[model samples]
Target: MHAGRDASDTLAALLADWQRARTPYRADAHDELAAVLVLAGSNADVERLNLAARAIRRQAGELTGPDRLYRLPGGRTLALAVGDHVRIRTNDYRARKSKGARADVLNGYRGTVVAIEADRSVIVQWRRPGADGPALATEKVSAVYIAVGGLSHGTAMTVAAAQGLTADRMLVYGMGLDPHTPYAAMTRDRLSAHLYLPRNVLESDADRARHSAPRNGAEELHRALNAYAAILQGDRADQLISPEPEPIAAVRARQREAAEQAEVQKMAQAVFAAAMLETVTDPRRPHGLLGDDQLQERISAAAAQTTALAKVVEVEQRRERQQAEQVTAVRAQVHAELAGERDRLATALTALDDAAHRHDAAQDRLRTAQRKVTALEATLHERYGGRIRGWLPSGERARLTEQLQQAKEKLTCAARRAEAAGRAEQAALRQAVEVFPAAPSAAELHQRLRVLANPRTFASALEKESAARVEAVLPGLADQRRVRAARMASPGLGDSAADRQHRARQALAALTAEADYRHRLDATRQRGEERARRDPAAPALARSRHEQAQQQAETRRRAREQQRGYRPSTPPGITAEGPRQGYGR
Candidate 1:
């Protein structure tokens, strides 16, 4: 199915099916789950097949990169680039690892060239256990001598080279071929396979003598195909039963030994077998057979067998019954124990999943905390290199800065409220002294504030009121914020100074994040549009340096928290020196 093989009579139908099957193949073949195999018989045939495949692949636009090529073992020059798959042909722990992390880039290990650092060395990534970090392990393998013998071509390989390899689909070229080697080559595909053989007609004398000469073209093809099929069916590596032809003397010796063994067994069991046969035989069934008394006498004489055989049978049957009971008991015990074990295992798996989730969350928090600590330490070092030099440690400076911002906000809110209150008090005092209209109601105040907040929408009406002096009822309009927040707990004026400072910091951070998000959104839009226009290649395999799925999960978790109105508390403390005790620091 992967090769789009279907029952078709016409060439067009066959080609159409192949087109669909080969829809999403890459020029580099990196996007393919498995490499296309062009199996051939000889080295020259292999080269020819490779040439044909290369010609067809290049029509799809070859991937361009720095002209760096490595000659593999067998004169195959493979060009290494990002996204090309490779398998380790040799065990190479002697080579230096990338980023000081050792990976088992041993023989038969498969990986993709995530990065080509140099002509001799490339960074290969091994798959991780989960979807979260698919490509987790990397190793930098380089040539110790001439070519990097560890790195080899993975897209196409010879039968000897493909010993332990597996693939998705295979194309077999069985011309001038023996089926012996192809046994290993053909079964490598897990999905689909095909065999293309050059028809071998019985034109030569030896072949014509062995096989029939066809009378017609169809008959010729039929004979050739039948011969090829017989060749394939007959030369199976496993079914080949060729021990060296036995020497005549050795064969005679074996035959004599087998005859002697048979004679010994026959002699050993002769008496008992004869007695048993005689005891079971009845000769009185036919009219001319022996009479009842004679038959009884003969039977009695035969039945004069020892009781030892009866004892042996009884003992064996008893032992078998006992063994059967024991087996039944054991089976019941095993079933009971297995049920309990399965329950325990299920419980353990559930607990393991929960533990894994908790571990992941803790790791994320640890990373966030570490980043914050690093930033704080950097600021501290920048401010105060030593104890005697600077006035504040990083934590102390941040605390003071936060306090200052809160203080300024509180001052502004208080001033606005005091001004508004003073104006109100003065108006009240003037009202007591002189005749004045009743004070405006709370609803009236709210309406006025709402108008002031969006003056454009009610601009003409408010302006007309102002022109007519109708706005002079109350002293000055309170701030457009809610009446309680405006007069009492405004931006930085909260239940406590610390609370207000935290709110201010949260607001500032939110604003900063929003601005950054807006910039990134625009960039993301442009990138997405451009990417949509780009040709589909190895995007499925060559994801970003880090997995986007992990980031997406983190984003989703944060979004859920935001939807629930969950706010994070300040992270724990760190200083330029190191982390300090939260109890005392």
Candidate 2:
């Protein structure tokens, strides 16, 4: 009796019984816990609905302070009187998930009952709105929030059959707007009914129409009520009441207006599509759209652009042509200058080659002259002690001066002969150059001939000087040889022991006589001195003569001692008369 039927009337009867049999269970308590009505919906929609409920709770000062009101998606809020006995309960779907130990996909909301119905369904209002747009639109209607199966705008009872439980007011959703038994049962027994639906009504209708296809007797009742309501609000209500046809012109005008509206709608759709296309393709021309007319205009503009580019290209080509002509003239002038420079360089190269050849020939001649000079110097140095220096006696100096003068004269003659030979060599070289194609310059030929002549002149000078030096040195050589011969011929050079003995005896005799004479002189001097002292008046002139004679005698003795090389004493083993000749021999 309770499973598939409207449970409102059965629940009402039970509630009345419970009130009648009310017991004093809480005798010491003044208040009881209120039950919160919980609704279920899609997870995201339910979360947003929970947020709206929080907002409304803040605005309305928390209608259900401790108990909550969870108004989920496909569910709405209904404002009720303060005195109405409201209740809140946990949603059956959430309770099942909590029992299974799974996370709640939908949250619970607090609700209060404002009205009751013959069925068990109740009109529940919460603390907040389920969505922002509807909540804002009817936000001013602070005391009148409605719960329906659809959006807040003209909420309807669509899922009356699936409502199952009876409440104070209709709370149906997830069904179509077709004539169905569940929809009739939902709205028929209730005093005030509210419906909850999706954001788009037509989509909801399409979705639920299939499920509501099983119609019943409620379909005839619904059609009758719709006819009655249409007539009461219809535009031709007067004509319908009187039964007459409308004028032909008026019918046609109405048709025309409908057609005009359809055309306007088509044009608006096209404009919106173009605006969307431009938003994606061209931000600068947000309102521009591509069409046949626009494409034609763009083509014409592109043609003009092409023509402008062609004109620019033509101008550039003309300027390039003038530049080319100027370049050609400059190139011709540069070529002429380069030709003259090349000829000058060729002549300079020829002059350099000629100078190099002349320098080589001169170097060869100078080396030959230096070699000849070195050889002649070595020969003269070996023979004559060339370039004489240091202490020469007067006779040798005079000889050297005469010899040097003669050498100078000889050198002059040799130089003349060398000059003649050089002239002949120069003539031969000139003849050779004449035979060749490129004859050397006169200056170059003369310089080479001078180089060749230097060696011969230097050699001749060396020979003359060597001869002069030999002549100057010859007299000194003759004097040294004569002195050597005289020393060899002396007879004393061969004297032996007998001659030495005879000389010694003679020296001894001379020494004895000198001693006797010296003694006699000393006696005479002493006697004279005694006589002078005795006759103090002797003549000064006589004294001077006597002193002079004493000095003369001393000088003579020294002379005789120097002439004989022996002392007064004879050497050992020699007799005073002489040495014995045959003693050793």
Candidate 3:
């Protein structure tokens, strides 16, 4: 067989095998043999055959037309028809370092240009194929070449290169028009250049160099050459040489200026007539000119008028000074009145505070005296039986009983005085509020109210706090009393009557100490309740908080009892001697 026929048979058999198997064909396979078969027939020389094969290889893997055959980079043959399912395989490879410390492939993931990085790599992002929704992924690669077919939106290229690229539309963002980037991103069918100039981008020296006068001159020369060619082709001699006529509108502007000048002259004539009419007919002179004697008389009259005006100005100045003095006196008087009012208000508040302090002191004394009297009575009963009046001879028991009675009476009188003083202080405060109105401060009013208002609530809180303190200390006092009573009962210990009396005195001192504790607790709680009522937005909330504190104290007491392995015999707020009589009212 002939060599050309044998090559043809091999090519034909390879094409049939590629058709049977569904795969894409790559171009670099058997390049020399394919060139021989392609250049075999017709008068096509070797050079033309080489060019044809190069052109065919250039479009090997691209989508050219419907139902066309394409060869991918892998060695396979496949049909690239419409509605064909194509899969792109992405391999994650480690970067290979070059001699210049540059990466040949920074990343291989396919995507659009998300950013142009500082390291001269372009960040590309695109959706993963067959993903749910528009799921995106990014890769950083060299900005020299971009595969734009994979991106959903358009990508941006930083460098300007115009070869081996195709697009439908292009946009230049934050950059001026460069000579090459515009052509690189333009579509062959229809190209529209859209420029977006952000604050970071400005026309630089390189842009001016590409768009200078010499470049514009070259472009104009081309346009002139085209026009001359068109003229030679057309044969119209007069049309090319005719000069354009001057526009009539420009000549029409001078007529308007002339009319404006005429109107100004007419206005001048009218002003001259008005001046002639204002002038008086000078019978002594032929022309309208003033004489030297008349001019001197006019000047003297003007001087007389000026002197009278100066006198009126002096009179006005004197009146203004008197008014200013009156204003100053009125301002000082108002300030003095305000100062006097402030001082008076301060004095009244101080007096009210003093009265309140006296009232509180009187109440404290009365409670203390009452507790003392109660303690003395208990002591008397503990020392003596029903024969208390006859137990002591030297009139000592009678004197002690009389003193207790007097203390009770004094407590009663003190309570009455305290009540009266509280009422008087409250009345004075109300009168001040009515008389002063706006003169008193809110703080002052709040103080007065805490001291003088809601006496019942204050009295109730005081009673409860006092009762709690007494209840807390009562068990210890009762235990001491029990021990003393046991000692008295068991005389077998060989104790004397004086010793028993001394023990009784100690018990009485304990009772006094308990009473003192209760009094001090009441005073502390009273101040807390008063402040709570004065400042808080909700007084009831303050009261509840106080109750919580009381509950917490009770819990701690119970916890101590539990720790000591002793069950509490009495409920909270209840003493062993039962609730104190005449309390909580």
Candidate 4:
């Protein structure tokens, strides 16, 4: 037994040496398995070497990379790499008999393949089909395992026969009774308690012992060859056979530190050389009068000057700080004062604007009133005119027509006198008379008279009337007609013919000679009332002092607004210190 063991050891060593010396079939398969083991054992180099050996034995194949394909039982095809292990199954039928019991048939069992398929399907041959039959005919059947290259005819049947034995029988009589198989089954939780029965109750141990004996003929031969092949390939070799060397990180670190130290020493030498060169080339002699004593004296003087300059600078800085504070305080006060002034001015400006608006509104109202008066005069003229009188109310039309007829008679008598003077005078008189024909009513006559008295001729008419010239006579005659209109409008006046004539003459004089006749008329009436306060014999004023005061206030408000002063605040761009803050700190 010892010699046989030595021979087996020698054979294993030779096989390992031969496997190591063999040429690789696929370079890509070698690389892939090397990479997988290297990654799987990153922590320890020794573990990596062991893993590499296992990967080489486990993954050796004729095909490279993942080029090979394997079809699984579920009808799905998968791309396979050299090291990929897969399960293959084939059906096996067997016939067996027990003493005084009917024979039984088993069918379609499972097994692992040793090599690739030789045909489209694994050829499964049945041993027997009936309870009482002899050994069955060897008929090849199609299945997943096929009749692969390395397996023999009866080798598959022998593996199937091993599944019938009890645990003790398998241990005593099996060709390879691996105790690790039960441990492995237990580790995987697949060992059933029923398979481990007591020896006396069922003779299970004896039966298994008889059944576990090694097979004869081709089955034994095929298993021997498979075992020999596995040993040659180093597939089941011991794990602690190879070891790896330690990493070189510490040596690399020392080399890097030494290089850094050398660089630092070189830099130090260059600095020392530069210092020695500077010392030799320096212009100032160390022992010269200007070098030691004079330099010391200069340094002392410089120190004293620095002290004095520092004091001066300190004083200037203090002054500047005080000035800055004062400037800040003044700026704050100025800002407050400016703010107050701005607010006050804004309020005053608002008030001024309101007053100006009120003044404009009052002027607009006065203009509107004048326009309304002009339109009323035009309407009255149309109502009083002979043909256009049809547009007016019957009562007002009759009254206006009577007044117009009287005014036309007076104008005709004045025109005839002017005609007796001369042809040129008559022509002028006739032209004036044409403006004063027999108007349809009194309002029409008043409109014609207003048109004839051109507002632009105020100065010339006043000059002529003051001198009692003949040119003013025509204007004076129109004035007398207006005086009669006023007297007729008054409700409670009963005077003698001479008094009425005198009042009429006074009104004509007021109209012809005054430059601002309307203003003079108002003033004269006021003066007459004042006089009548003492004499009780004159008319009252035409306009009130309240109306005059309101007009004067409105005019003053408009003038103030025109002279108003207001300015908006300064924008961001143009300031005292420029726009430097936008760029710098």
Best by TM-score: 1
Instruction: Give each model a TM-score.
Output: 0.30, 0.20, 0.21, 0.20
Q: Could you give the candidate ranking by TM-score, starting with the highest?
A: 1, 3, 2, 4
Ranking by lDDT: 1, 3, 2, 4
Query: Model 3, 359-388: lDDT tens per residue?
Result: 788889888988989887886676554675
Best by lDDT: 1
Count of backbone clashes for each model?
0, 38, 7, 6
- Which is the better candidate, 3 or 4, if ranked by lDDT? 3
Model 4, 181: alpha-carbon shift in Å?
A: 81
The digit string of per-residue lDDT tens for model 1 on 1-585 reads 111111111111222223334555653343353455444566444443333333223222242355367765534455565655566677766436545356555675555667666456777765534466445567777755227466654434556656666667666555446658767767988777665443332133466676554566565556555656677676423345556555865676567545644543333233222222222221211111233345455444434322334455567568657655654555555445434443444444344444445555555555555555556556656666677757544577777456555555555555555555555544443432222123143233334334444537445544454433322432322222244364365644434333444444454454444334334544533343234324243232224313555577789999998878854455557989988555411
- Cα-based lDDT for every prediction: 0.47, 0.37, 0.40, 0.36
**Model 2's TM-score against the true structure:** 0.20
* lDDT tens readout by residue for model 2, 1-585: 111111222222222222222223112111111111112223222322233333322232333333322342333333333223232322334337468553222212333333333332344444423355212110111121223221121111113212443333333321223333434544432233333332222222443354453254354334323332343344222423453355865576556545644543343333323222222233222112223244345545545555555566567567556644644454455444434433443343345445555555555555555555555555444555545533334565555556555555555555555555555555545554453224365545444334334666534544454334433544353344355456457745444233444444444444444334334544533343334333333333334545676788889999898867554543446668876443211
Higher-scoring candidate on TM-score, 3 or 4: 3
Between candidates 1 and 3, name the one with more favorable TM-score.
Answer: 1
Clashing pairs for model 3 are 23-77, 23-78, 24-76, 24-77, 25-76, 25-77, 112-125
